[model samples]
Target chain A: MDAAVTAAFDLRSWSAAHLDRVESALSRWVVAEAPAGLGDAMRYAVLDGGKRLRPLLVLAGAEAVGGNVQAALRAACAVELIHAYSLVHDDMPCMDNDVLRRGKPTVHVQFGQARALLAGDALQALAFELLAPDDEGIPAGVQARLVRLLARAAGHEGMAGGQAIDLASVGLALTEDQLRHMHRLKTGALLQGSVLMGAACGSADAQAQDALRRYGAAVGLAFQVVDDILDVIADSATLGKTAGKDAQQDKPTYVSLLGLDRSRAYAGELLAQALDALAASGLRDTRALDALARMVVDRDN
Target chain B: MDAAVTAAFDLRSWSAAHLDRVESALSRWVVAEAPAGLGDAMRYAVLDGGKRLRPLLVLAGAEAVGGNVQAALRAACAVELIHAYSLVHDDMPCMDNDVLRRGKPTVHVQFGQARALLAGDALQALAFELLAPDDEGIPAGVQARLVRLLARAAGHEGMAGGQAIDLASVGLALTEDQLRHMHRLKTGALLQGSVLMGAACGSADAQAQDALRRYGAAVGLAFQVVDDILDVIADSATLGKTAGKDAQQDKPTYVSLLGLDRSRAYAGELLAQALDALAASGLRDTRALDALARMVVDRDN
Candidate 1:
């Protein structure tokens, strides 16, 4: 396709095909084997739900770099598993205590807390397991790089660390900078890691890597901004989660800090920044990445 | 040292030296960097406690194969971190609900459930992070191998799976095979993974690998059998945690399956099996492995 045609490419169809592939891969990977309840809870947590945005970012990142399809698929699934596991753990009574997610009962609510906890723990390990399979198709160097990136993003320095901050910040007012720092570790790190993991599947020049990193950061933050806005404006039915949870919990959010109108504008600005980074990447096939940035900024949920 | 001297080596001194190295490495790795409370909980969960048997197993296995010291140290700390994380989670109110561990207040009891949960999650990620560092000292192949081994041992097919089975089997009668299967996955897997991870740090022939696997499996099961015996015989203070928890929870155990005398006899048999595997390994410097087997079988706590 030419530039104009690629620019006008049907993202819905593209995403649909990718989502189907991811769903099938996830179903195959998340099995209900010997330990009956744990496997079932894991499958319940992972399969048949959500946007699969992290996986999409992974695939887009890989596509941008002309990366291997098989490796990219594995990376995509791995990131989604991490994201899913995080959600399972976060929804527990000790944390968010939410009863709903993805328009359905949360894992902790559907399967009791103990099973939910084990399911999350198992999913996290499964993510790394998928990334570093005993297959010769994936190079050892690639496996090591993927594991290192994912681990850091999911560990104390990243998502989990950010979560600790979120927990401590409950019912407390926070400055914009502190909120941004918290969001960067909490949600931004894994999203950035997804993009880098996709890049790791293929080779990228330093210039391209820098651009993708910037693009990932902007998109990651933009997603969160949009999320906070939706939490305020959209109902629980539309958002597929408990609406206005941040305000209810007295937790700080971008919408709370910048106001809804400004947060929406900020998301748009981040979208522009993400697109600019893509342009600077100097790669020819970043249509999916560009479309994804638009989707993140535009989505209601 | 000469063969006779090596055969008659003082195991206590040798273990003490290795324990010192493992403890120092763990202290260096388990840092309380960011997210304030999360790091504290992680440090609290990992530091200043436990027998460090898993780390010792890793060191001994590495030593048996002349593995790289740095790689072995990393593996040792990584395995212990995984173990510590499991303990933190297991002690949570949702699971075992114990108030004390290592003779101190459990993580959730001291830091609250949220911090404890995040700490456990972070520790798990930290374990993988330690295994696959962004360094050239450890080869990519070795990192991939170590990660794959550890993940499988800790995931659905291993420790987590065993825990699920344990949870479901509470208040239910289990056959000998069923009980063994549970222990194999729960405790045996990580123990065996430690041995395999150590072997991964060095070069081992196929025959040697088989022997080590047998040795690991035997020792792993032996450790659990002894644990069951100790749970019945030892008091709460002596065990450093709640004693008689298995029976209290109505959980099936080796002691319940094969009375005390038979359980003790089974542990002795397992120790002999482990030693025989070590002998079959044809590795000259297995003094440490032999002594460890004895310790596992003989230890009251």
Candidate 2:
């Protein structure tokens, strides 16, 4: 579609409708009455939190592939759960030691460290459980596919693997290639996996799937690149998290390696790459994915 | 199905063969080359540790139900991964503050708290990944079923939920019913889940499934009762963990509530109940499950 058509697509309205579905589904699905108030902590970590970017990607990707509605919704919620759980654990004193997240006290700060630990663990399990449902509303093949995609994204070879590199790389200077590798595993895998999962909900042929993969990769890396830029430029108030903390922690980043100007330029390049991939996808509609790509690169947060 | 026939079934030989399969599958499947040494910590936590009782239970349960071989093996490892991950997290300073486990330093003590946390998180994801493989060796329906079963066992409603209660109930004088509820969630869910998951790998009739469920419940509870008894009576060296830990932490247990003689008798009763359930299952062969139940109640450590 042309820029005029894309601009007229009303991304906000689309997001609003989808986010409503996602929020309601999450509220219903996440356990709130678990034994010993564990559910309370789980609900606290997940509900009313973050920007829901992952869910948007899932929904958008599913839309691109004409994916199954039920599967898409579950995939959306499951990806978000994984994201939320990572934040909970990362904020622990043992990990990032951060006190604040999304403008609220971190889970460990609010509900003691032990409950926070279990809450994160439970959330991770819930992600997989949600992906692989008992009923046939989502096909068995689709269910297993979603589960594999999600687990690979969230598991050791993906997000956790990246986080390990992050933890071990403190005070070390990493080359651009090394930084990209880490970011690709850490943040990029889940973002790409979200799209793949959404596509898995439906049937996307090889060509279309490959194009979406490219789109997802470009968009995912752009997110981290933009994040690095924002850390340098945005304040904690605007970011809804502690900004410039990467520098404080001596962690390597795109901005640190390439300078602010180069990092900004790199994010722009990635956005263009994402848009090109979406154009080449051969799908009739990719407005949501297009808008999300722009939003990732342009958002103040 | 007579006791004489059961006695002649050779549980040790059966377990030895299955345990070998489980070990090899685990070694090959659990990520050993994850970025930044994360894999090292994960392997350490999972390998050369514990009795692998959960895997044994899963294999036995599957055998009893004539489960699909591939799915059964995956379920066995998946349940054990959940068990191992739980142990890793539970041993952290914020939770049990355990220094040693499986006769060695805990994950946190050996790998540091941060890597321990990530390793546990990754392992949980891997469990679901293993359950929901991409190929068709295990049917998609079975994959989805196993994921649901394992997640419910490991998530907020099961192990994590039980742990939350345990954390809250520390130093409190819990009644027998209250203790049972806590232990059921903490340990029983996964144990029962292993059986249920094993059953899920095959086409067990509803009647047979119900019988297996009963057997699982009885055996699961008996395992914990025996654990409590061992905590009081067995030495740390014998138990491969710190004996008397529950008492030292002021955590309530069967020994603390019902005392030794009563706990022993209760365990015996549960074992009988388990045996009865196996007979009621009407499966052609339940010798493996029968032997496992006996092992759970009769083992010293």
Candidate 3:
């Protein structure tokens, strides 16, 4: 295999181990020994398969700054939980009303809307709980920073704001700037958090954190652009979920606005920008960062 | 007016002033000079009329312990923002589907579901942001504690968990214990946070915090039970929003499970328990706590 593919597979293995650790910690903190049903929905929401890209960025960011991945793992899980909660709630009847997620019935479809909503709310709370553990090894200030960042990213100016823009632009064809603004808040912000959180892991210098943030923004938008491209080319079997749903929903996408060819070009440009940011940070280990940039567009999923 | 009534009204006014200050600060922090429209939806969500009861409790809890109310104000406003967010999301089409709230169309009704959802999410983030202001004088550990407490109350075992139970038991007949569990999770959790936060406001002893927590828990349930009763007895005009909708939906309620008279008695019992907890704390200036406990069931909204 080429170095790129080898790195992708290697990073996949590396990120999976960290993710498993995160998932285990989450299960311990959230699930009680009894009342299995209440926790069942939580598990269902968390365990649903995804790329684990955000968590990987967090670990990578931390590792780049000589911090242990283990220290940052809880935050990794917390961000994922926030992301999962968003999806569950977003699929509700009043929202996107999606039935299939990851090729399975959505949480609301299986657990009912009320439970789904509650599950989402609970998950959001769990994110914070995970960040502010009873053990105070992490500095209180850092924990507080984590709380503030995650909350803002998950809330208005970031993900929620993006979703608001998306919702408002449903029928209308939004301008390129408008679409970018929406995507930046919705997807870019969380991805940025993943990186910023990693920088936060072991007192990484502020300059490094700032550089990684730029990298995160570039990668996040590139990830979305690739997604829009894949929706047209990839089949549901390879994608492991519904494909072309964006087009069907008439949701404005990079491909719809910029066309597929230009969108792919944009992804490449963003990947370069991300790498440039990492280089600017004066980081020596580019292995994980390099792998992530390649994986953003190259993966079938 | 009775002394209790007079005190409650005075508190209502005083709390409003504090809330206005907090709201103004929040607007300054979150909104920008440009993008007036983007910030407008969020500003509306925060500025909309509601009794700032949660913030009042935080201030009350602080004053009860002889702490500076100004020091506790940020945390108070943060909790209230979270509460407001929950209300916005809860009234969306996927959840309660209510059109009116606080005598106005619900966020979703006014801004559409997507914006409403986003607004709710944003507000949640803003609450956390408010908790950890950079130049603020509160200790970092205390702020971290506040964030953790609020997170737990809002998350799985508190408000969200309560919401899950409520969603699960919509048509089913729940036992009295199950009903209490729901209310405790949903409403009791935040209420408990209010008291704990208040106790944390100054340098109250742990014992005092614990006593106030018990007081909070008791009063939380009392408050919800009163809400259940009011829904049964009060008209929409009096309540300022939809009334009798809970029963119409056939959702489980305290009154439904225990009957109206029994529910009222239970509320009284809870109020007494709250008072006992407050008294056990040995607070000298029990005026705020006393007024708050009385106000739990006395007011219309």
Candidate 4:
């Protein structure tokens, strides 16, 4: 097989293994059951099927810096847990009130909003716990940076801030800048953190970190734009979840502001920019990243 | 001064210094801006007045093990941040819906529910970031243990689970065992974690850790019992917040089940148990821990 083809297969296999490792670690860590009921709610929320994109970014970023992908797995898992928590809370009746996620009923829908809220809260706390360095993982400073990055991304200026803006912007005709601002905080923060943290875990230098960050930002925005496009174009059956909920709610979206074609075009442009940033970094191991970026835009769900 | 008295005074002084350090570190760290709006909300929630009990536990525990109080401050601050976040969310309109906390408006009332929720979420993430071993303070294993302990305490089986049970138990009379179970998850998890993490940070052995945990659980229950008693006896102004809200909400309390006098007596017994645990630990630095146990029952706010 060609090197590119081999690399593609390797990436898929590696990503799957990384995800499995994360799942196993979570199982080992969360044992003990008077709490059995609480565990059920959390498992329902986290085990719902999805692409697991954030963790892929962490592993790929780590690999790009010549670090062991396995070593970065806990941080990757931590990021995913944080993401899952956000989804559970966002689906609460008082928040976005989402009823379905990844083809299954949302946490709030399945477990009730109060439990869902607590599950999210606990998951968020658990994410930090996961990131606390173990004896065999990446170095302490790198671990600290990863924790800091994930925290900031998950925090107010990042996901939560984005959520606040989203809540506030409902029924309001947000400007393009306002819409972008919300996306950056909500989706972009963790997306960027995922890649940067992965790279930092691998001990990437300042220049490399900057390049990875730019790459992350571009792809993060691109990911959302693609999501907007899919929301408009894909059917619920194909998407494996309810589509057009955003429009039904009259929440502002990239497609709403830019139209379908423009949004798709914007996603492409961002992908190109992300790829260009990756290229400029002059790193040899970013092939996985490049493929991941392309896959992001091309994904239908 | 006698050794015990001197130690008690030292702990008081050290706690103040530790709090100051946490405040300064947090101020210094949140310099970046895209998330600026949420950042402000986060700072507002964290900076508000509270007892600072969890952080003090971390500092005292570390000091007990002969660790530098300053080194443990970041971890201490992180736990406090998580606690603050929980309080913020617990008071939301969709949750407990309380209006007053520490004699001031709750975060949701002051900043709006959406902002408060985001702030709480962000703060939780920030807490982990604070603990992730950076810049010559604590070791990675200690940091890891801290993160794991705090996470487990905050998650489904701990504080969040406790909240779930509390919500479920409303309007329904619960047995004392059930009530104790609820308190253990809701309040004791974090309390036990606070002392354990502090001792671990100071490099306490497993035996010491277990003893501290026992001390923590006793004091933790005592703390809640005292709060319940005060709710009946203390005025809103003296309490620095509303005192009758719990009864008004008809939430389960030791006082409701056991009456005020029994609750007070139970609290005293718990305090004695905590002091006894401290003595059993055989540490040279039991003075601070002893004072803390006494303070838990006597505290008015």
lDDT of 1 by residue, B1-301 (tens): 3366375767789889998988887888778775868888999999999998888888888988899888888889999999999999999899999998989999999999999999999999999999888864888888899999999999999999998888889999999999999999999999989988988899889988999999999999999999999999999999999999999999999999899999999999999999989888977577888898899999989
Query: lDDT per prediction?
Result: 0.90, 0.91, 0.78, 0.79
Q: Lowest-lDDT window of 10 residues in candidate 3 chain B?
A: B29-38
- Residue-wise C-alpha lDDT for candidate 2, range A120-238, written one tens digit per residue: 99999899889877675788889999999999999898999999999999999999999999999999999999989888988998988999999989999999999999988999998
Q: Kindly give the number of clashing pairs for every candidate.
A: 0, 0, 2, 1
Q: What does DockQ come to for candidate 1?
A: 0.85
Residues B22-54 of candidate 2: C-alpha lDDT, one tens digit per residue:
999999987688878899899999998778889
Model 4: lDDT of residue A64:
86
lDDT at position A180, candidate 1: 87
- Least lDDT summed over 10 consecutive residues: which range in candidate 1 chain A? A1-10
Tens digit of per-residue lDDT, candidate 4, span A1-301: 2365343346577767777876777666544352536677777777636788998898888878877565578778888888988888877776777787888888878877667777788778767766764666456666666676887788766887788788778888988899888998889989998998788777677778889989999999889889888888999878877899889999999999999988988999999999989878866588778888988999988
lDDT string, candidate 3, A1-301, tens digits: 2354343347777767777776677677657421325578877887847777887877787777766455588788888888888998788877788887877888888988767776777777788877876674877777877787787778767887777677767778989888888888888999888888877776666667777888989998988899889999999877766788888888999999999889989999999999888878866565687678778868877
In Å, residue B155's CA in model 2 sits off its true spot by 0.6
Better of 3 and 4 by lDDT: 4
- Point out the higher-scoring one by DockQ: 2 or 4: 2
Residue A131, model 2: lDDT of: 83
As a TM-score, model 1 comes out at 0.98
For candidate 1, give the docking quality class from DockQ: high
Minimum summed lDDT over a 10-residue window in model 2 chain B is located at B1-10
